[model samples]
Each structure stands twice: as C-alpha cells, then as structure tokens.
Target: MKIAVVGATGLVGRKIINLCEKYFDSDVDYSFFASSKSAGSELEINGNKIIVQELNDDNISNFNISLFSAGGEKSKLFAKKFLDKGSFVIDNSSAFRMMEDVPLVVHGINEEIITEKTMLISNPNCTTMGLVMALKPLHDEFTLKSIFPTSYQAVSGSGTKAVTSLEEEIGLGDDLTPDYSDGFYERPIAKNVIPLAGTLLENGYSDEEMKFVNESRKILSIQNLIVEPSNARVGVKTGHGTFCSALFENNVDVDEAINLISKFEGIEYWADRLATPLDAEGQNDVLVSRLRKGLSNDKILNFWVVSDNLLKGAALNAVQIAKHVSTL
Candidate 1:
C-alpha cells in the first residue's frame, strides 16, 4: 500500500510517519507532505531520510492512502479531494468527526464498524479517546445516562511550539520565570494551568470541552447523553488525564464495573492505585483507577482515566484504523 502523511513536519504528523514506518509492512510505500515552507526538507523514517513534499491538490490526488493531521482548514479543503482520488483517508483533525456519514473510530473499541465503504474515517480528539476507552465497557454493561468530565491535558497536545515553550520556561530556574509569548500560547503554559483548550463556544463551553461531550456520544453511539466538560491545559508533556463522574440507567456494581473495565480493550485497570499522566505518557492503552461510587445513587460511578494524547488520541488510532481497513 502507498500512504501519504499530511502536515508531515508537525508533532503529531511526524509521529504518524514514524509509527507507520515502524509498524507497517516493509512493502508499503510512504510519502510525506507539509507546507511550502517545509517542502524539500528531509525527514528520517525507519533509518531512511525522506524528502517532504509540498501539499497540493495534485499531490493529494496521487496517493493511495492519506493520513491527515494538519489543522481542520487544510483537512476541510483536501480530504474530499483525496477520497475522490480512490484513497482511504484517516483524519486526525476535528474536520469530519460528527458528520453522519463519517465513522469516528478507536481501533479496539469500534474496529468492527469499519468497512471497505468507509473511505473516510475520523479519529476522535485525544482527550475524548481516553475517556471513551474507559467509559465504553461500563456503558455497555449499564447504559450511560450522563457524564461530568474534567480534563487535565498536557502541553504536547497543543503542538510542538507549546512543548518548546514549556521546556524553555522550565529551564529558567525557580527564581526567574519565563514570560508568555504570543506565538506559543494565549497564556503562560510553563508552570501554570490554563482553563481553556479550544475557543469558547456560544454556549459558554470551550470547543475542546464540547469535543469531549459531542465526540464521546458519537463514538459510543449514545445519543441524547448529557455531558458537561471542563478542559484545562496543564504542565505535563504528553498524556491527557480525565476525571469523570457519571450516572447510568441501571445500578452499577463497583466490583463488576472494575472487572469489566479491566477486560475492556485498550484499557488497563488499577483498582487499588491511581493512573497518573506520567504513568500514561508514551503508552497506547488508556489507564483507569481510583474508582468511586456516587454518594446518592448506586447507578452513579466515578473514575480517573489517562492516555498518551499523541498515541491513542492521534497517530496510533489513525494507524489502527488503517490496519483495520486493510484487513477487509
């Protein structure tokens, strides 16, 4: 199979290229794409340096499989063009996720939903991916009624610039603080936490918060499921951690739910301990721990979930979808 990776110079995009080279069969052909500024640059993939190609409609039309990690604007303009050229698209951006026709997939959870007809598959946001992996099994055992989630996301999710900003600030030592530059983040992301993720919606929730609410429902096939989310940027580097309090339609037994979550694909359960962002960094599986029963209703349950935003949230999930589609 021939594959093209869009936004090849960016953080998630580069990771996708590396993963494809490392995991995919040696017979597969790989191409990399970036903006005009990054074109002609060389990127090493699987011990070989590959030149980055400039992204254009013509180049997009030539690839067999295109994995897009560029922002939504780029995806909105070129995704259909690639699909029109007989290429399967697994997009990591938020472009076509909620479209009625697009399937937002997490490999272990919804691989069965993919088919040859699924020419365009959407990968959910990093935060939503981690939460759903932990919630899906419980939702299956006892239908989910509502969820209140608060996310502490890492700086890496913001991109390479944000990661550099954090590292630069941390290098300034404890006495001297680094100032926020307009190019990096809206506010200082070095040692502090920012209460916003994406832009604020008319409904007063941030776009990142709404993504968790909407994308979770779409991926889990739970319509009319009420979700309240608060997304914040933390000082961490890679993982995204979420705390969720949920109410289920049927009474949920704590022990049973814990067991079910442990067996859930792409989830690791730690009943007696906690799953921290540091523990989840660089790992693909979503980690769940600190289970608690709601005070008022036995149907209510609470837990902490964490996963690598770049892996489960982006590249790994996109690659898994490609693998799933190849099998069909």
Candidate 2:
C-alpha cells in the first residue's frame, strides 16, 4: 500500500507515521508530505530517512491513501483535490465531519459503514472520541437520553506551538508573564486552566464543546440526544480526560451496564482504579474508570474516560480507517 501522510511534521501527523510503520507489515511503502516550510526535511521511519515533500495537488494524487491531520483550512482546501484523484483520505480534522456525505467514523464503534467510495472520512474530536467510546455500548442497551461532560484536555491537543508555549512558560519564573508569540492561546496554559478550547459560538458554547455534543449524536445516529458539555484546558501534556454524567431512556441494571461497558471495543474498564492522563499517554485504547451511579435518576450513570488525544483521538483512528479500507 502506498500511503501519504499530510501535515507530516505536526504532532498528530508524526504519530500517524510512527503507527503505520509499527502496525503495518514491512512490505508497505510510506511517504511524507508537509508544508513548504518543512519541505526537504528528512523524517525517520522504521530506521529509514524519508524526505518530506511539499503537499500539492500533483504530489497528493499519486498516493493510494492520504491521512490528513493539518487543520480545517488545509483539509477544506486539499481534501477534495486528493479525493478527485481516487485517493482515500482519512481526515483527522473537523472540516468534513458534520457534512451530510462525509461519515464521522470510529473503528470500534462503526467500522461497518466504511466502504471503498468513502473517500474522505472524518475522525471525531479527541474529547468526543473518548466520550462516545465509553458511552456507545451502554447506549446500545439503553438509549442515551442526555449527557453532561466536562473535559480536562491536554496542551498538546492545540498542536506543537501550544506545547512550546507551555514549556517556555515553565522555564520562566512564576512572576514573568508568558509571551504569546502567534497568539496561540488567549491565556497562559501553564499552571492554569482555561475554560475554553475552541472559539465561542453564537450559542455561548465553544466550538470544542459543541463538537462533543454534535458529533456524538451524529456518530451514534441519534438526532434528538441532548448533550451538555463543558470543555476545559488542563496542564497535562497529552491525554484528555472526560467526566460524563448521562441519563438513559429506560432503567438499566448497574452491574449489567458496567459489564457491557467493560466489553466495549477500544475501551479498557478500570472499576477499582482511576484513569489519569499520564497513564493514557502513548496508548491507543480509551481508559475508563471512576464509574458511579447518578444520584438523581436510577437510569443515570457517571464515569470517567481518558485516552491519548494524538493516538485514538487522531493518528490511531486515521490508521484504523486505512486498515478498514485495506480490508475492503
């Protein structure tokens, strides 16, 4: 298989290259693509140096599959160009996720919907990916009535620049105000929590919070499901942790729900132990723990979920989509 990784120099894109080499057989051929600023740079893959090429229509059309992690604008501009050339694009951005034609996919939850014609599939936001993976199995037994989620997302979710900002701030003394070079974040992300992730919409919700609410319903195939989400930026470097309190349609046995949740694919249940961001870093599976019953409703349940935002949230999901495509 010939694979091209767009945005090959970014955090998520770099992780995708590593995963493809780690999981796929030695026979697979891989290529790297990046912006003109990063062109001609060499990326080490499987102990071989692969030169990164500038992404353009001509170069993109040559690959059988292209994994895009660059951003909404880059995806909006180049996705169709790659698809028009008969290449399958597994996008890790929110650009095409809610589109009527594009399928927002998570391999363990909805791998069956994937087909050869599915040229551009969108991976859900990192926070949403973890929430849905933990909720889907229970939603199957008892439909999800409503969800209230609070996320403690890592600085890495904002990309490489944010990571640099945090490191620089830490290096400076506490009294020194962290300088915002490109205005990456509204506030200093070191030793502080920012209540917002994405821009605030007209509805008073940040784009990140709305992504969890909207994408979860779309991926789960439930139109009227109610989701109340509050997104926060924590001091963590990689993993994203979400605490969800959900209500179901019909009363469900707590033990059965726990058992069912434990069996859900891509999720590891830790009933006695609590899952943390440090534990989830570099892992592909969503770690779920801190399960509890809601006090108000017997049908409601609360739980905690965590996963590597760069892996299951982005790179690993894109790689899984490619694996699905290869099987077809």
Candidate 3:
C-alpha cells in the first residue's frame, strides 16, 4: 500500500506518521506532504528522515490511502483531488464532516460506512472523537435522548504555533504577553482558562463546541439526539477532558451501564478514581470515570472522559479506520 500524510509536520500528522511506521506493512511505500513553507523540511520516522513534498494537485495522487490533518481549508482544497485519483482520503478536518455524502467515522462505531465505493471519509474533531467513543455503547444499550458536554481542550489541538504561544507565556512571563498575538488564543492560556476554543458563531456556540453537538449525533447514528456543548481552552499541553451528563429514553441502570462501558471496546472506566487528562496523555484509550446520577433523575447519568487529542482523537482513529477498511 502507498500512504501519504498531509500536514506532516503538525502534532497530529506526526503521530499519524509514527503509527504508520509501526502498523504499516514493511513493503508499504509512504510519503509526507506539507504547505510550501514546510514543504522541503524533513520528518523522521523509524530512524529514517523523509523530505515533505509541497501540497498541490500534481503531487497528491498515486497513494492508496492519504491521511490529512491539515486545517479545514486545505482539506477542502486537496481531499477531493486525492479521492478522485483513487486514494482513500481520511480527512482530519471539519471541512467535509457535515456533508451528506461524506462518512464521518469513528473506528468501531460507524466504521462500516466506509465501503469500497467510499473515496472520502471525515475524521471527527479531536474533542468529539473521545466523546462519541464513550457514548456509543451507552447509546446502544439505553438509547440516548440527550447529552450535555463541557470540554476542557488542550492547547496542542490548536497546532504547533499555539503551543509556542503557551510555552512563551509560561517560560517568560507578562512582558512577552500582549493582549493577544498571532497563533495565541483570544486571551491568555497560562494557569487560566479561555471560555471559548473556537470562533463564536451566530448561534452563540463556538465551532469547537458545536463539533460535539453535530459530530456525536452523526457518529452515534442518532439524528434527533440533542447535544448541548460547552468548550474551553486550558493550559494543559495534551489530552482533552470532557464532563458529560447524559439522559436516556429508559431508566438508567448504573450497574448495566457500568458493565456496558467497561466491557465496551475502546473505552475504560475506573470505579474508585476520577480519570484526568494527565492520565490520558500520550495514550490512545479514552479513560472514562465518574459515573453517577445527575439531576437526581433515574434517567440521567454523569461521566468524565479523557483522551490524547493527538492519538485517539486524531491520528490513531484515522489509521484504525484505514486498517478496518483495508480488510474489506
């Protein structure tokens, strides 16, 4: 198989490359591509350094599968061409996610949607990726009616530059901090939280927040499922934490729910301890804990979710989908 990783220098893209080296067959031919500024730079994988190609129409084809973690605009520009040229495009951007024809996939949840006919696939936002993985088994058992999530996103999700802004503010203090500068968030992110993670839309929901609302419904195959989402940027370097309150159509069974999630494939639950982003950092598993009652209602339950925004949230899930699709 021939594989390509777009946005090869990025945090998510680097992880995708590492996993490709680990899981891809020894005979697989792999390449990396990036923006013109980063095009000639080197990305090292499995002790070999490979030069990144500039992303353009001429150079994107001839690959069996192309994993894209470039921003939405670039994915919008490049994905279709790759798909049209017979490379299965697994996009890690919100660009094609809400489209009717595109399949937004989580590896185990709705991965069956990626058929031999599917040329393009959408990977969910990093935050929503963890959220839906934890919700699927519960949605299967009790039939989810509504979900509310408050996400604490890490700075790494914003990309390499945002990480620099955060580091500068942390390492050097206030003098370097302007009101807000390039690649930094709207406000500071050191030892403080910014209530918004994405641009505020007309509906008062940030784009990051709506990904939870929109992508979860799509991945769980629940068209009518209602989601209320709140997103914030924290000072953490990696891993995103989400606290969720869910309501089901039937009465919530704590024991049965616990069993369903604990035994469910991709997520793990801890009964005695609360799971944090620190515990989930650098890990692919969605660490879920804190199952309890909310609103004192038998139908409502609360849980906490954590996962590395780069690994499971972006790269691993994309590769897992590609792996599953390769078998069929």
Full-model lDDT for every candidate: 0.87, 0.87, 0.87
Question: Which segments of candidate 2 are over 4 A away from where they belong?
Answer: 176-183
**Model 1, range 60-151, lDDT digits (tens) per residue?**
64566789998899999988889898989999999999999999998888878888988999999999999999898999999999999999
Relative to the unseen true structure, what is the Cα RMSD of model 2? 1.7
Instruction: State, as a TM-score between 0 and 1, how close model 1 is to the true structure.
Output: 0.95
lDDT of 2 by residue, 1-328 (tens): 7888989999999999889887777677788888999999999888889999998766765578889988889999998888887789999989999999889998899978888877789999988998899889999998889999999999999999889888877676575465543335787777778888888999999999999988999989999989999999987889999999999998867788779877877888887778899999988889988787788878898888999999998999889889888778
Candidate 2: 10-residue stretch with minimal lDDT = 175-184
Q: What is the C-alpha RMSD of each candidate to the true structure, in Å?
A: 1.7, 1.7, 1.7
| True-structure lDDT of candidate 1 | 0.87
- The C-alpha TM-scores of every prediction are 0.95, 0.96, 0.95
In the range 1-328, model 3's lDDT, one tens digit per residue, is 8888999989989999888877777677778999899978898877778899999888866888999998989998888888887888899999999999999998878888888888899999999999888888888888899998999999999999989988878875665554645438878887768899989999999988888888888888889989989999999989999999999998888888889888988889988888888888878789889888666788888999999999889999988987876776
Error of 1 at 54 (Å): 1.0
Clashes of each: 0, 0, 0
